[model samples]
Every structure is written in C-alpha cells, then in structure tokens.
Target: MKLHQLEALVASADAGSIRGAARSLGLSQAAVTRALRELEANERLPLLIRAPEGITFTEHGKVLLTHARIVLNQLEHAHNDLERLRGRVEGSLTVGVTPWITLTFLAEAVRLFRERMPDIRLELVEGLMAVAQPLLRDGSMDFAVGQLQPGASELEFASEAVLTYESSVMVREGHRKVRARSIRELLDEDWVLNFAPDGKRDLVDYLFTRHGAQIDERRIVRAQSVATLQTMVEQADMCTWSPTILSHVPPFGGRLRSLALREAFEPRQLGIVTRRNSTLSRAAVAFIDCLLQVIRRHARSAKKEDLALFKTLELLI
Candidate 1:
C-alpha cells in the first residue's frame, strides 16, 4: 500500500479513532476515512471496523499494522540519519533501559544528550530485555541497555557489553538474613527474584540446585522488573537477587544492602542490545556516547566493589 495509506492505518490504530488520527496528522477526519478506505481497496480486505467506542483492527489489519509500524519507524530513522549527515541536529530516538540503568546513570546521560542535540526528541522505555525484544525487532525502539544473559545470541540481536560484574542477593537494611553467607542459608527465607520461562534459567532453581537443596518454591515471589523486586525487598521481609551495583546507588544505598554471600553467581554483563541487521541512527550513536561518558565519570568516584565495574568497562560498540 502507499506510504500515506499505511500511515493512516497505523495512526488510526495508535490513536484509537479516525478523528484522533486526523488531529495528529493535521488532516480532516473525512480525508483520513477516505485514505483508510483506499488502503482497504488496495489490499482487497476490510482492515478496520469503526464503532462508537473507536476502531478495532481485523485479522488482516492486525497483520498489516505490525509491518506498517516498522516501515514508518524505519523511514523516520532514515530521515533522522540524513538530517544529521547534513549537520542538522533534529530527530526522534527511543531507547529501552532496564531498571538499573534507569535508576542510575540514565538521567545524566539524557542531560548530556540534550545538551549536544537539543532538537532531538528522546524517549526512554524502562523494561527488561524480554520486554524490549519485540519493540527492538519491530523498530519501535532503536536499542536496549541492560544485563545481557546467556542465549541472547539465539534471539538474533547484537550486544555490546560496557560493564562486567556479578549479580548479588539483596536484602532490606534490617533483614534477618542480612548476615547469612551462602545460598543454603536462604532456603527458608521469603525471596523475590526474577522469572525465567525455563526451569534451568530460573533463579530459584539456580540458588537451590547449586547448594544441592530443594527449592522452597512456596515461599518465593517472581517479579518481572528489578524495580518491583527492589520495592518488595525494601518494604517487606523479602530478599531478591539483583545486579551487584543495584544497592550501591542513591536511595537504595540507604534502603538496602547486598548480602555479601560466600557463594558466587554468574557475572552480569551490562550492555546495549540492538536488532542484528539494524543500523543505528546518528541520534542513537550520540546518546550512547553520552552514556559512556557518564559511566567513565562515575567510575572515577565509585567506591563499592560492584560500582567499580565501570572501571573495567569494555566497549564493543
């Protein structure tokens, strides 16, 4: 279908109605309706059903909307690239950031990025790689920054590790298990850890299996985001497995502490994830540079063993 037609469809779906789409696109509602009708005629299928509540996509419409968004997003990237190449600092950028990044150095990076490219529109999505994968694949996000786990290569994404550090078991300031030194000591404790679809990758399994003990699945809580995990740890009698650097930052530094267990877990590699074949726009590159700058600056003053991971930062970008 034509670009305008696809834009009309995507805009309608995004805005939830033809009127809203017309307003966003600065066109008349009748023109938007005609464009949608023409798009349906070109495809020989009904795309949207208009109702009082708004619009709903048909099966065919749903399928087209996926590709439509990717196409539109790629076109925007191309436009941004050309503008930057011509010495114009203007465009949009969407970067997915995990909780650790969002709570730590992201604010400084954004400030730096804004100073360098004030005209660019910056959008930050706080989520894990699991949440970011589809968005990155569909071109809704340019890249993601977080802890890269094993098997990430199988997802057809490229990653660049900036910091290498171990994950830690965290507890609230006055937690009963605060003095416990090993995984075995945590069996009876109420734990809040991340979820993995497979049993082998699950943190509960890892903690117990390593100690040759049975998992206390009944007392465990599975959380999707580190933010949620930290909240539970701080406000309740729950301990969570988190990045080592998580407890070293502000607010959390006062609210929580790393368990300092005698046992070791897999090293958490913090990095940037992007679609395998995707070319980052100029804005993406500039934003990442600012992030690295912040990391380097922070490393100079970081005192904790975990926070010092930035000193060993390796850039594969």
Candidate 2:
C-alpha cells in the first residue's frame, strides 16, 4: 500500500473516526474513506468498523498500524542516514532525563549545544530512570543521564562521574522539620517519597528502612515528578529527601532549606549514560561532549552554595 494509505489507516485508528482522521491528515472525509478502502484491499482484511458512535480499528488493523509506524520510522531513519552520509548533521535527538537533572544541568547543556550547533533538533523526556532504561534499549532515546548502576555489562552504556552528594530532609520554607537537622525529628512527618528502582530511590529507602525510621509507606506520597514533588513539599508539610546539588542554584537553593538527615545515607553516584555500541550522529556526539565540558566547568566553579544545590541532585563532575 502507499505510505499515505498506511498513514491514513494509522491516523484513523488514532482518531477513532473518519472525520477526525481527515482533520488530522488534512484530507477530506471522502478522501480518507477512499484511502481506508485501498488499505483494506491491499491488506486483504477489513481495517475499521463503522458504528453508531464512531469508527474502531479491527484486530488486523491494530497490528498493521503498529507495523506501519515502524515502517514509517525506518523510512525517516533512511532519509536521515542519507543526510548524514552527506556530512550534514540535521536530525532530531531525544534524551531521557530525570526531573532534578532537567532542572539542573540539562538547561545549561541545551543552551550551550544550541549556541554551538544550531541545526541539530532537540527533544527531552523527563522521568524516572526505570522508565527511561527500556526506551534506551529500544533505540528510542539517543542517550540518557541517570545514576551509575551495577548492570553495565548487559547494555551498551558509557558513564562519566558527575557528582557525589548525601541525602537531606527537604520541606517548605516554614515547615517545622526544616529547622531540625536530625533524622529523628523528621521521621514522624509525612514524606513525599522518591521511590524508584534507581540509586536515588534505593539509597534513600535503604537508609530510612535501616534506621527504623522509614517514612510511613502507607502515608507516603510517591511523587515521581520533580515539579510535583517540589510543589507538594512547598504547599504541605510533607518532606522529601534531596541531593545537595539542588542547593547550587538560586531559588532552588534559597527557596527550600535541606536540613541534614541524621542517618548516614551514603553518597549516590550521579553521571551521564550513553549507549556504547550505538553510532552516535556527529551532532549527538558533539552535544554529549559539550555536556561533559559543562559538567567539568560546573565542578570547577562548585561553590559551597552550589554544593548545597548540587546536593539536591547529587550533581558531580
């Protein structure tokens, strides 16, 4: 079938109606219906069902749609590969990052990269390391920045030391625990827990659990979002464990005070992770190098105040 026909079917499945799909594809309703019929004929199976409410994809249609997307992506990659062969770095790069890192070094890295290489497209997906790992393996993400974990032998990954930092109790400006530098004083308070499979979550949970002062898992508010967690900590008395890196920047360092946790939560390793075997485009490689340079610069300029901010993120270079 034609690419347009494939796109039509996929769009129809996504939109759930010919009219909606037509709008999405910038085609007339009759044109969309014609394309759907052509695709159905080419596949030798019905692709959509028309009902009172709207249209729905048939089982065969769903499978075809999945393959269609893969095929389209391959075509785009082919085009990009040709562009690369011409020694032109002009395609998009998508990087997955955790929220705290997004608020910290990523902004600087993006700014420097854009200034240096204006032609390379950029995209960012911010989330937990657990969620980002699979995408890295699937080749969806070009690279990521997360904790250096134990299982590097299995994946194509390269890591660099970013920073080292300890855990601290974080609360809104006026929260009572903000004044208490001891874990005991903060234990009873509800915590906005950061619990994921990565080192940050693991180390924080390990310390609290071992100390017999684990935040009430039942009362715990599991906020995977950095912005949400920050907002929750700011609006309510709920406390969160943070890396000292956050204290490096203003508003972040100045707005929230991280009282030292009494328990010895070991310093977590923070770093940049990139696929080892993957052939990075020149643009992507350049961006990564620029990011490493930025990390080095930040490290040399690391002031006591910055470490306080870096502590919030465990940022090291």
Best by TM-score: 1
Provide the overall lDDT of each model, using Cα atoms, as 2-decimal numbers: 0.80, 0.70
lDDT of 2 by residue, 122-177 (tens): 88888766666665655567677776456652365666666665556677777776
lDDT of 1 by residue, 234-266 (tens): 887797877766666666766887887777776
Per-model RMSD to reference: 3.4, 5.4
lDDT of 1: 0.80
Identify the candidate with maximal lDDT: 1
Candidate 1 similarity to native, TM-score: 0.82
Minimum summed lDDT over a 10-residue window in model 2 is located at: 308-317
Off by over 4 Å in 1: 44-46, 85-87, 148-156, 194-201, 209-211, 216-218, 224-227, 297-317
Query: What TM-scores do the predictions have?
Result: 0.82, 0.68
Instruction: Quote the RMSD, in angstroms, for model 1.
Output: 3.4
- Candidate 1, residue 303: lDDT: 65
